[model samples]
Every structure is written in C-alpha cells, then in structure tokens.
Target: MAVDVLNESNWAVEPRVFSDLGLWVMDQMKISTDCDLTIIFNEPDAMEELHLRWMNLEGPTDVMSFPMDELRPGDGTTDVEGMLGDIVLCPAVAATQAQSAGHSTIEELMLLTIHGCLHLLGFDHSDKDQEKEMFGIQRQLLLTYLAARPGELNEVIPLEISGE
Candidate 1:
C-alpha cells in the first residue's frame, strides 16, 4: 500500500501515523498492496468550504472522504487496487472532539483516520444497523492497532515524518 499524507493545517500533524493507519485499514479490508491512498490535513476554513460544497452541510466537520475507483470489498473475487482517493481532516475540529471525549488530540485524530478510511472502503453508517457494524469495526480496529504498538499507557507514540 502506498499512503501519502499532506498537512496544510495550523495544528501539529503526524504524517507517519496517518500513513500507518491508512495501511492498517487497507490491510484489514484486504485491499491489494498496490493500492494508493492519500490523507490531507487542512484548516477549518478550507474544510468548511468542502463541507458545504460536497456534503452540503453548514459547518466544518472532523473528516470527509472522497473515494475514487469505487472499490468494494472482495466477494469471492480479486481484491481492489488503485487510488483510494482522499481524506480531508480538520485537526481543529478533532481537538474539540478530543476534549469532549476526554482523550488526547492525537487519539481522536487516529480514530478519525480510521473512520475516514472505512468510508473510503465503502462503509456507511446512515442507518442503525450500518452504524452498529461500522462503529464496531472501528472499535475493533483501534484496539488491534493499539495492542500491536509497543509503548507506555496513554503515550502518544513519536512519529518521524520524512519528505513532508
């Protein structure tokens, strides 16, 4: 999987973790290794414009996904491979949600990353059953990712982002 992270926000961004989360989501969804994905961190003003233009919502949201290739999970067929499109994330919004959730901003961002990736993979939560399945899978993925990391409790893992 080739995951590209671009940060154009005022807040501190962790590109490596975003890339890792993309890869992890792809792996869990059985996407092909040749798949390419992009995650972008942008300012609230830009996000608000996108929210209004794409979703027709009034305010800036935490994350928005624009999936390309229309890739769906494999059903006794070959796995998906191609550009997975872009995920636009607003760190400012995430920070507020993090405070409300009583967690660090990075944790909240990680959750949002997983959520965006799921949307890119054709997961929807518009209905009750869909919400249950999507949220359940999100929780499972977060737990699995956390368990696999080697770090102290509540520690924000240091990430080294190269080449911006």
Candidate 2:
C-alpha cells in the first residue's frame, strides 16, 4: 500500500508518526495490495463541515474517511492493485481531544488514524456489538504498535473510546 500523508493543518506532528500509522494499518488489516492511503490534516472548520455532512453534528470530528471503493473480496485482477482510501485528520481537534483525554497529541492522532482505517476496512462502531469488536481490535493494534517501540513510551494512557 502506498500511504501518502499531507500536513495542511496548523498543528504540529512528527512525519514518522504518520508513516508508522500507515504501516500499522496495513499490518492490522492484512491488506496485501498496492493500496494508496493519504493522511491529510485539514483545518478545524473543514472538519466541522464533515461533522455536519456525515455525522450531522455541528462541531468538528477527530477523523473522516473517504473510501474510493467499497470493501470487496480481492479478485485475481491486478489492474487496480489496491487503492484502499484516504483518511483525513483534523490535528486541531485531535490535540484538543488529547488534552482532554490526558495523553500526548501523537497518541491521539494515531488512534484517529486507526479508527479511520478501520472504517475504510468496513469496521463501524455505530452498533453496540460492532463497537466492542472494532474498538477491541483497535486497542490491540495500538498496544502492539506502542510495545514495538518502547523507547517512545511516555505513559500507558487509556483510549478515549472503550470497547464497552
């Protein structure tokens, strides 16, 4: 998968974190295609638009997904290879949420990326059962990612959204 990260937001984030997120998403999903994923950081106001359009809310959301195609079983056709989708993140919202959740902004961003990627992979948390399954897997993947790099460990923070 080709993961492209674009930082257009006013907030600051390390580039390597974005790359790590791409790898984590690919590994967790077991997606073995030349998928192209773009992580764009947009203005907080832009996210408000998404909140109104997608979630029917009046405020900004942490992340949004724009899948290019519906999730389908892979065919033998290698024409498209694999183009999963694009995940747009609002760093400002992430930062704010991170502060409220008492965690680093990077952790918040990573969680948002994982959440968006899960949506692209057809994981939704709108229902109770689905929320448990999806959030459980998200936390597992996040713990794995964090454990792999112990040097970067700052704290064992809890996730904002729980499996329950």
What TM-scores do the predictions have?
0.89, 0.82
List, in order, the clash count of every candidate structure: 0, 0
TM-score of 2: 0.82
Cα lDDT tens digits, model 2, 1-164, are 37878877766556567766676667556664457778888888988997899878898888999887755333434333367788989877888888999987778888889888888878899999999998998888888888888865354342233233
Question: After aligning candidate 2 to the native by TM-score, how far in Å is the CA of 40 from where it should be?
Answer: 0.8
Which lDDT value does model 1 have at 49? Answer: 99
Local accuracy of candidate 1 as per-residue lDDT tens digits, 60-104: 999999999877765536777888878999988998898899987
lDDT measured at residue 164 in model 1 versus the true structure, 0 to 100: 40
